[model samples]
Target: MKLLFLACLSPKTGNYTTAERIRSHIESAGHSCELRDVADFHSPSDLAHLVSQNPPFEGALAIHLFKAGRLLLDLRLPFGVIFGGTDINEDVKDEQKRVVMEQVLLKARFAVAFTEKLKEEAEFVLVSPDSKIYVQPQGIQTEVAEQFCWTEFLRSSEWHSKNLHNILIIIGPKVDPALTAEVEAVVKRATGVFLAQERSQQELHAAMKRCYAVVNSSVSEGMSAAILEAMDLRVPVLARNIPGNAAVVKHGVTGLLFSSPQEFVHQSQRLLSDQELRERVVRSGKLYVEEHHSVKQERETYQRLVDKLHKAQFLA
Candidate 1:
């Protein structure tokens, strides 16, 4: 199938937007796929003239739904939409944003929501009680993820290894200060990396392999790349207790969930102090992600949707 992938890609940093991954996955399946970073347009960049008019794409997959790119909702092409965090978490709460989001939802041949919670939220936003929304987890190539030796990372003076463990926190400029500061008290004493920017996919997987645990502190999210990647590497996750985080991490089995920073630190330290408990959570987390977030599974679902959409369009 010929496909045109559309989304804004953030380069010069380890920002792997979901749209890029879907494009890569589709291409690997022997389907022709081309990616255009629409956000880079109107500014001088190496990839200028990104796309003034939509290319002749048989299938157009829009990863983000925003006013800047809302034209896709009205385009003639049979499009697929992949929901990002902002579209649901923040935008849907606003009247104008909700309307645009709903418009995009209705235009899609099928909607791809990374989490079940998001699928539900999108349904409410669209008010199409019967919208065809697919709850597919973002796939991860665990085998190819970079593996690193993290002895030094564990040996820092603040890294209390005696009765503590390293728990990695992943986020970027998108994280709010209030939430970060609130969780700081819980994480300040923990031996972990509090990164303003996430590591590259390779570096991230490598780091996950070395760490005892991963933390999700997002006050709001759709489905987190950090939590899923940590699962791929078999790292235990201690995620914030929210719809987005809850949809991914199975409480008590995959990881502990908390609403506050104090709770995050408390649960984290508890998980660290118990080896057997940690192992159990990691084991469950690994199997859970591999089963649901596998690349092949998502491809099959997408193919089916595309095929169905083609038939419906022909019938009309």
Candidate 2:
């Protein structure tokens, strides 16, 4: 079968990771898969022209409901959608996008949400059949570089030894500007907290090893890859207590959860001062990722989803 996969393939985003991973599994299953960045197509007509090639695709898969799913609305082939953070968290608040997303859900043969909470939010928009909306956590695998010396990296960057115990707040390009501003304000009032922006995945992992604790300040998420990465690296996580963050980090067990800037500061200090707590959370977090978010498991699950789609095609 020939499949068209549409997503925002920005080099550094989670959606890019997801689309590429799914494409790999689909192609490995002996199907032809073509991946196109949604940025390349302006409308459903543009996408239709692309898919209308000689021997057109049998099916399509899109990453974000509002962004990529909207462009595939007019597709004649059976297609599925995977929800991005904004679709359920931010865009659903907008009346127009919510209405359009409802129509998209109705047209879709299946949809995926990273968490049960996300599935619940999507079900409210359109009462799709239970089997259509799947709650699958993102699969993750991580390996810290053998030569990664966090202290050396920090020294080379000229950070003070006094601040060596500082927290690392990773700021990605897609994070909400207002949330970023809010986190920045919190950072200003706190001591020994710094933002680590613009580093590649490997570099970020190395940096995370040296930090006292890593912070995830996103207002929303679709199973944050960063959180999983931190867990895999044995770094204790301190995240904003949003539903997305909460889903990944189990407060007082796997990691600490904070509701406000003040709570975040308190938790960071507590995590730093309490070595027992830190070690316990780090141990539990590593185990959780290994048990639940294995890359192998994720690959197999996606293969199953593709196989399901193909079987339905055959039945039709």
Candidate 3:
């Protein structure tokens, strides 16, 4: 399959990570993928190219919000949207933001969200009830620590002196550091180190297994790749008590959640103290993540979605 994939191609964040990873997947399957960056882009931008030219693509994919995809509506191209968290969580709130998103979805042949909550939101908020919406968690390939030193993850922050106690917060653009500081302060009673704004998803996941727990302080997410990666690595998670995090945590089963800073601190202390409890959470979390969030399954589902859209558009 040949694909003219459209997304923000800049690095240093999750959007780029996702675009790069999936672009790799598509190429690995023997498809040709042309990636474009909207951030470094200009007006009458790729939008004009998509609208004016007859693309050699079977179907197109729009992977970012704002400028990358807003043009697809006018092009009337056969494309699918791989929605980012901001599109559903933040952009849907403002009237202007919502308008762009609505146009993107309405023009798309299908839309993919990484979680059930997000699928519901897409159905209710931006897309037609009949519009095809798919739920596929972002896939992760787990790496066990062998040659890599766990100390390297800790060395920079002097985390060993912090009692080998550290919390990892991997940030993208929408991540609120205010929430990060609050999470840090709450976990401080336990005397743990809180490291913010990690460089890569692989590094963050590796650290999740090394740390006692992983903390997700984001107020919103489309299904956090971090949360699933943490659960898969069996580190146990302490996350915000919100829809995106809640869909995975299982509340005291896999991990705990809290409404306020104090409550989060209370749960963190409880998990720290109870050895047997923490072990149970880790066991259940790992099992649950593998069963529900397999990358192999997700990619296959994605292939089927692409085939379906292609058939609907140009084949059938």
Cα lDDT tens digits for candidate 3, 180-226: 57766775654334344444555555556667787887787767777
Clashing pairs in 1: none
Question: How well does model 2 score by local distance difference test?
Answer: 0.80
Question: TM-scores, in order shown?
Answer: 0.79, 0.87, 0.81
User: Per-residue lDDT of 91-181 in model 2, one digit per residue for the tens?
Assistant: 8889889888888888887898888889998888655777789877888876565555544224322344556554344445534589779
Candidate 2: minimum summed lDDT over ten consecutive residues — where? Answer: 150-159
lDDT (10s digit) by residue, model 1, range 1-316? 5666767666522224566666666776666777777564432232223333354456567676663236565455677777888787887778887887777777677777787778777777666546578888777665435455554444455555443454354544433488657666666655555534544567656666766777777687777777877877888898889888898888889889998878887898789689988988989988888888887887777767667655654554
Tally clashes: model 3.
0
User: Of the candidates shown, which would achieve the greatest lDDT relative to the real structure?
Assistant: 2
| Candidate 3 error regions (>4 Å) | 9-12, 42-44, 50-55, 64-67, 144-162, 166-197, 312-316
lDDT of 3: 0.70
**Of the pair 1 and 2, which is ahead by TM-score?**
2
